[model samples]
Target: MMEQPLPNPILFHPLKHHLGYLRDFAAQSITWPEPELRKAFQRIGGSQLDLYIGPLPSLQIAEEVILYLQQRHLLTPEPYRQHLVPVGYRLCTLSDGSAWALRWGLHTGRHVHLHPGRYSLHTLRIKANHLKTALAVTIASIKYNQPISLQLLNQVRAEWLELPPVTGYTSAEGLGKVLDLVPGNA
Candidate 1:
């Protein structure tokens, strides 16, 4: 008999595991331009870069951004499928084994959500060059006031590569302490 794979793996991505702390850290990094910083904070924190366009611009622009980043190998899609569900829950897989799972809550065309699939951190690690690419994607989406491209992504990715990864945030409090986002000692 062959061994079977576990149905679900553990969540161990340092940044994602303690996303709240990371969000706070990123939010507090900027001081001036309080309003814009606050908005950026919410967008990056929520991992919803679609809001940067004021009123959540068209999904077309977001697709364009995805295309640009994908071409540069900044972000890749994971292999997965969805079961029979409502229209809003459906996703169309691409030729490159990728898919788009957008959320069309009220203002459908105005917002282009990232494929709302629950991807395992382990899969992200082994397949998509680790969480570094996700970080690069987030930075690329945020830094651009207008233009979005592989060149911009590469630049941000290079800067991010310099920052070494710090692991071992087993507890929420511990993560908060290291990020200096919360007011408590864990």
Candidate 2:
């Protein structure tokens, strides 16, 4: 049998509408509001909190942390001291605006030379019933953790931009078509 060519996947930029959807999803997913919840948002086109990492130790570290977070979400932010924790976590959104928290490190870590180290990876599914409470917990998680780095920060952003938006379709045939495309420098 002859080989058939694949259909061209949709190529596009990260749309603000999609990002807004992600932020809303994240906010709704967490449900319960907290004092830190406002700060947890990583602003994108406007009030949209696409993906939030941390107040890394410095701009460099913040950048790294953002990059790492980007691999999973649609929008992210530049690193800032205001956001740093002893560690870092990402509240991310799918390209289409579905939200989730990329929890890094165990919620608790031992001090290393007076600096915090050790991270864990976890994913908590969002539920309409407990969105508010979950968001409160996410805020607490990022705030208490240690900082991340700029290299990894940018990595997260790069990764996010590279992927297509999340949609109702499942299986590789859906959004998976982007996998065959080459990545561009963000």
Candidate 3:
């Protein structure tokens, strides 16, 4: 049997790593609605978030925390609204009209840009739902007795993007994927 080939990262935005930002002609257009989300998001994109790790804490701990949250359905990250590359950067679709990749990082340390959508009212709501879910993951870290490093949280986001969307969910139950922790860059 032959191994399957991996997908290529879109060359259109070679160095772009920001989430929700769309670019064309080398100039960026639009900005994220909630700027703070950028910080949380950037860590997963490529940058590292120092949440107590402070120069070499156990990365294993970081990975564990995020997996725990997902197992409980506390964080059901919306799948990457874009390409299926294995790493670094992807062109995500935020909504119909608006898109903004905060001048930040990438997925699993992967980085890329996004393309705009139709800008319909329904798209807007979906965009909002997407960000809300991402932030919900962040909030869980803050509320957690053992705070989860944003880097790991974003890594979880990276892995989640590789999955199918969690549909027909209830607040009481979480996404159906079993708890399997993806190894970290550590």
Candidate 4:
């Protein structure tokens, strides 16, 4: 039998390929202030945003993009409340037993729990940095075409554990529900 070479892995740029669509969606859905939105996009690098471009538009990506804009102060609170809060609610409400959903639930929970403006800028910056670190790990995993590491999963679990007890809000209640669903949590 003749030897055959292994096929090359297909390389896909998740952000690069989806940037146009994302920009259009942002422009249409999010109300940005004057030229600030344009400035924000110029500052954002392809690798800075992690999007999963698939057959369907991903709510996850939308949430992440909105969060990124929120973090940068490029958009007003209305968009975050309008877009991200709803997505967070949906994610937490519909989360499953899979680890992927669990991670996303935690992500959404954190954002919902620590909404910008509600918290002090100092606190929001600290939490945002933590999220950015976790996102960097995810981006690296995607860049290398590798599965997410157990360490990263543990880190996410730790962050979930560290979340303060839920308050009386419906969104927080949804997050609390997800907390109860976390494996090993009583």
Candidate 5:
């Protein structure tokens, strides 16, 4: 029996619709209505207040839009700050799911990471697992009586991104358990 060839990994690029949404969002003529912004965000799969992280470009665009809106005072700072918590949670979920897929050798091509530079599938997998572990630790600290704060979550995410990639293993179950400890999870 011969091993089957893996399907080509899908190369990811930011979608035109999403880019259009971002452009319209940044345009000065627009009144920056919250409802309209929410609608556009939903259209780009942000309805649940969770960002799409599969494509690196989409995440980058969302970050830029969030920063732009905040800088312009277009969005209420508190609510938007709370929104960052879920975004971090979503990143952990993505990392866990990606690790599982890589572990099974399924859809390797779909695991592309484009930011900072294009990364090979193997490197992407390693980074995903490492991120999951780092985030899990951060959440655990919160669970063990550390106060939950948006500033801390933001710091953890920024630090994780800046850290050199290293190999690590974190089970989906481990991530899921810590995730429940996140604020608003009840």
Candidate 6:
């Protein structure tokens, strides 16, 4: 008998809705003004504004999106995927008291527990620079209360990581040049 392929570890609840929303919104960018977004927090049962911002997806809704991206051949190369692995729920925690908790580090995997809005902007800038278009776009969306979409995410992933079986090109810049080859976003 032949061995079967094992299921991906990241396939979990919450990801489905997250990915579904991402795909829908990616077709068009959606903006959530600060007040409306704050109202959404209450609708979702979260009590504070800080609970909703981060590089990683919401703990309750990321796996599905990541897995869908992987299944659709939309994920970046192994290195980038590997970096994303430790970023999910394993890196996050809800504090029993007070209004703060820990978030995982992208590079170090270290748990830096602190209050929200207390991180380094310089590091965020570095990450945005490295990730290319999507990062800046997402940050802008977040700042302006916008919803992001999958096409845009796909565009960004293509820029940062190659489709498997790596060939010509090494970074987002190369990907951007190649994108010009196609007539439309596709």
Winning model by lDDT? 1
Candidate 6's residue-wise lDDT over 103-168, tens digit each? Answer: 333433322222223232211111211223333235334444544444544443453232122233
Count of clashing residue pairs in every prediction: 0, 44, 18, 0, 1, 8
Better of 3 and 5 by lDDT: 5
lDDT of each: 0.32, 0.26, 0.28, 0.30, 0.30, 0.31
Local accuracy of candidate 2 as per-residue lDDT tens digits, 1-186: 111221111111111112222333443434334433343332222221222122222223223334544453422222221233445543433332333333332212211011112221212212221222222223233433422223332332233222222323222441222111101110
Question: Which model scores highest in TM-score?
Answer: 1
* lDDT (Cα, tens digit) per residue for candidate 4, span 28-131: 42343424433333333423223222322334433454454457563443443455544442222112111111111133223332111222221111222223
Cα-based TM-score, every candidate: 0.28, 0.16, 0.18, 0.20, 0.19, 0.18
RMSD of each: 17.8, 21.9, 19.8, 19.1, 20.9, 18.2
Q: Which 10 residues in a row give candidate 3 its minimum summed lDDT?
A: 177-186
After superposition, which runs of candidate 5 have C-alpha atoms over 4 Å from their true positions? 1-116, 119-126, 146-186
Clashes of 1: 0
Better of 2 and 5 by lDDT: 5
Pick by TM-score: 5 or 6, better one? 5
lDDT of 4: 0.30
Expressed as tens digits, the lDDT of each residue in 25-118 for candidate 3 is: 0122112233444443343343221111112112222233334334644322223322233543332222232232212224433222222223
Pairing residues by index, what is the TM-score of model 2?
A: 0.16
Write one digit per residue (lDDT tens) for candidate 5, span 1-186.
Answer: 111222223222222122222222333213444344333323323111112223333444334433544565534434433444543211112222321111111234332222211232211212232223333334434444454344444443344333333233233643332333222221
Give the poorly placed runs of model 1, Cα more than 4 Å off.
Answer: 1-35, 45-87, 108-116, 120-186
How many residue pairs of model 5 clash at the backbone?
1
